[model samples]
Structure formats: structure tokens, C-alpha cells
Target: MDSPSRRPDRTISAMPQHTPPAPVVNDPATTPSALRRHLARWPTGVAVVTTVVDGRPVGKTINSFHSTSLQPPLVGWCVDHGSSQLDDWLAADGFVVHVLSADQIPLATHFANRSADRFAGIEWTAGLDGMPLLVADVPLRLECRVRHRLPVGDHTYLVGQVVDLTAGPAIPLVLQR
Candidate 1:
């Protein structure tokens, strides 16, 4: 028989074949389950630290925050040592803390993510210290000037002297394992 329709329209029906490679674990390292267990045991509070750089607002969710000294109105928090945003924060004169209320867990999670526009849909006002203030429901707020910083562990300990503060009637959020 003559070759069927080889002029213009010809069909070659064939199945695409691929090799199935063998599955093997070359390096067995810690898995997500292991990390989850470790992180789960550590409880921390959620605070949104806000500041302005070049007339723009920059904020991040941080749990590693505490009062350093009451006499000088100093407070401290740890930021990842190699964070790209460090330059802006270090250069900025001051920052504000928005102590999330018990019902504002969603706000904490949103700010904590490594995404764009953390201030979107959040009501805030610029404070005298050139920091952003929580205009809505926040249990506490502190505007502080960067006093000192020390490298400790995997983060930079930023100690700030309180320049101004404002507190709301909302309840403070507490995190626990």
C-alpha cells in the first residue's frame, strides 16, 4: 500500500516516553516537623514596630521585644542581624511600638510576613518622633529614639529611649506555648 497522506497532512501516533528515575534521599536533614516542634514550645508576644524612612512607613512584626530600662525609658528588640531593612531602621532616629490586642492576632500575622505593603488597610498616624502610631485598637504604644545597639546571637539588640508614648484601652495580647 502507498504511504497514507504524506503530502501535507500525515499523522504519526506515538506515545511520549520518559524514564522514571529512582528516588533516593542523598542528605537527610531536619524536616519541617522537627522545626515545628521546636518553635511550638517557644512562646512569644507579637508587637508591630513602625518607623518612617525617607517619608515612608516601614514596619515589621517582632516577638523579641522587652523593656530594657525604666529609668531611662529604654526598650529593646532584636532584629535579624543580616536583615536588608536594617540600614533604614538603624539610620532612622526613632520607632513606634504597637502592642497588639488580644483580638488583633491577624494584624500580627500580616505584618510578620515577608511581603509588600504591611501598612495597607491599617489606620495609623505619624508621631512626633517620625514614627507611625496605631490609630485604632492598640493596647499600648511607645515612641522611642534609637539609643544603642549590640550584636547578640543571630540578631541585633536595638535599645531605644522612650521619647513619647500613647496607650489605648484595649487589652494587650499575650502569647504562650
Candidate 2:
């Protein structure tokens, strides 16, 4: 019966140097970039919310997505008030949220760029209420109808009631910074 107290000390010469204490932000910075830097440490999954605007497919890459309810199956994400497709999303009949796979960084980057056409070379199909849905193989896809829209500060939080969804056994893309 060997006990921890009886165990031999295995310390070798100067292995694993002591790490410095993490930097602390005592007084929260006032700049927007400061807030971004503070929040960059928290990892989040990436999602592309798509809808039809002026008969064209519109989409945006966002990390602010979460499941608000299970029985009613409610999901929500936030969109910046300065987004060009704000009005389109607000008036959209429904939208689809695509959970990108771990290897889908290109797709996420394309959607994140506001200057690109977004869907010019992308493969997608029409979804519920004529909303645009990416055809790429992803981790999960949710078809949702607009449930609520609330303006908060510089962003608008959009809530959606998931009417249908599909999930797969795969890793999802996560954003850290």
C-alpha cells in the first residue's frame, strides 16, 4: 500500500520555469478597442445568419449566438446597428443560422467581409420564407422565423424561433480573438 507521503520526489533540474502573473486591467478601459481586447479571451462559436434582401441573399458572420430556450426552441444573435443589411434582417420573414464546421474558416471570412458580394461564388439554396441557406456541409443548421427585435445600445438583438433544425457529429468553428 503506497501512499503520497511515501512516494519518491521526482523533481528534475529546473524543469518548467515559473510563469509570470497575468496582466490585470484594474480600471476598465473606456475605448471600444479596449473592450474588444478584454473580451477576446472568451472563446465563442461562429455562426452565419442568412436572409434574403431585395431578392438577394444576405448574410453576416457573428459570434454572439446562443440558445435561449429549449421547449419553445428559441435562439438569438446580435447584429451591429451599423450593418448595411440591418433593415433587411429586420423585415425578413425568416432566416437560417448556419453553424460552420471547424474547417469552414473561408466561408466565415467571406461572410464577415462587408465589401464582398457574399454569395457571388458561394453555393446556397432558398430556405424557409425564401431565406438564403448555405449548401455547405456544416455542423448544424437552424431555420428560424423572426420572433423579436430589440435595439440595445449600438446593436440590435434578434431573437428567432427555430421551426426546424439539423445537427451533425462534427466540430464547430470557434472564435477566440
Candidate 3:
């Protein structure tokens, strides 16, 4: 019997080629609903990004706050593009990032309200450059000065250089969505 190795008709070109489908290009605006749903799965700590404008205190509750750098101590948070207080926050000399305690959900809710006076019944003190620091017995507080501002999509990313910080024994408030 002739060995199969003696066959010469077979060649590498005898195999069929397969091509992958074109990648899907989805517009960001078209998928925001899904994106939002996906993002809600992530858990984050809550903070009130506070600053003083002129003679009064102003702030907004946010979970977008995070540390950006270690050297020179940088931190950041995002403000909505259409926020009324965006200008005040950008113009302020300094601001404070109050990392709320788990028991301070009321403080977070208070700041989240747009129509309410955030500091009306809340007790707070002035931090660096007289920026309002909510005295909610939080786990951590950072006094920072705006270092950079970048407009991205529907939000303004504000990066601040930490000037001072304080930490407490309280547990931080965490949230999902």
C-alpha cells in the first residue's frame, strides 16, 4: 500500500479562510440609558464638594469625587455642564471635599436637593480660605484649591490640589447608583 505521505495534491491553500465581522460603532448618546444602568452597578463613596462664593457657602452632593495624584496631592470631581453653581465653584478660591460618614446620609440628601438651602440647618465651619466644611463628623475631609478645569462632554472636570486634610474614625458613606 502507498503511504498517505506520497499524496501530492493536498496543499496549504486547500483550507477555507474566515473573516471576522466589522466592529460595531455605537454612538454614546444612543446608549446612555444602558450606560447609566451599567454604571449604577458600581459602588462609590459619597462626598459633598463645597466652596464659598462671595460671602455664602455653596455645595453639591457627588459620588464622582476621587483622588487623581499623590505628589502635589491632587483630587477631582465633576460638575454637570448646566449646573447653576458651576461658575461659583470655578471662581472660588478654594473648596472642601467632605467624605460623608455612613450615618450622615441626611447631609448627603440635603446637599443633593437643588431647591433647598444646603446649610440651613446644618452645622459647619470654615476651612481653608473660608470654604465651608460640613461638621457632620465625616470620615475624611480635604481642603483644596482648583488646579485645573476641563470641559468634557456633558460635564466639567475640576481638579484641585489638596492644601490640607483631616481624617476621623467614622465610617465613610457608600452608595450604588
Top of the candidates by TM-score: 2
Residue 26 lDDT (model 1): 58
Model 1: runs farther than 4 Å from truth?
1-42
Number of clashing residue pairs in every model? Answer: 0, 0, 0
**lDDT of residue 105 for candidate 1:** 89
In candidate 2 the C-alpha lDDT for residue 50 amounts to 93
* lDDT at 111, model 3: 92
Give the distance in Å from residue 147's predicted Cα in candidate 2 to where it truly belongs: 0.7
Rank by TM-score, highest first. 2, 3, 1
lDDT of 3 by residue, 73-134 (tens): 99999998788788887787777999999998988898999864678888888888888988
Cα-based RMSD of candidate 2? 5.2
lDDT for residue 21 in candidate 1, whole number 0-100:
69
Question: CA lDDT of each candidate?
Answer: 0.81, 0.88, 0.87
Report residue 160 deviation for candidate 2 (angstroms). 0.3
Relative to the true structure, candidate 3 reaches a TM of 0.81
Which residue window of length 10 is worst by lDDT in model 1? Answer: 27-36
Candidate 2: segments with Cα more than 4 A from true spot: 1-28
User: Residue 17 error for model 3, in Å?
Assistant: 31
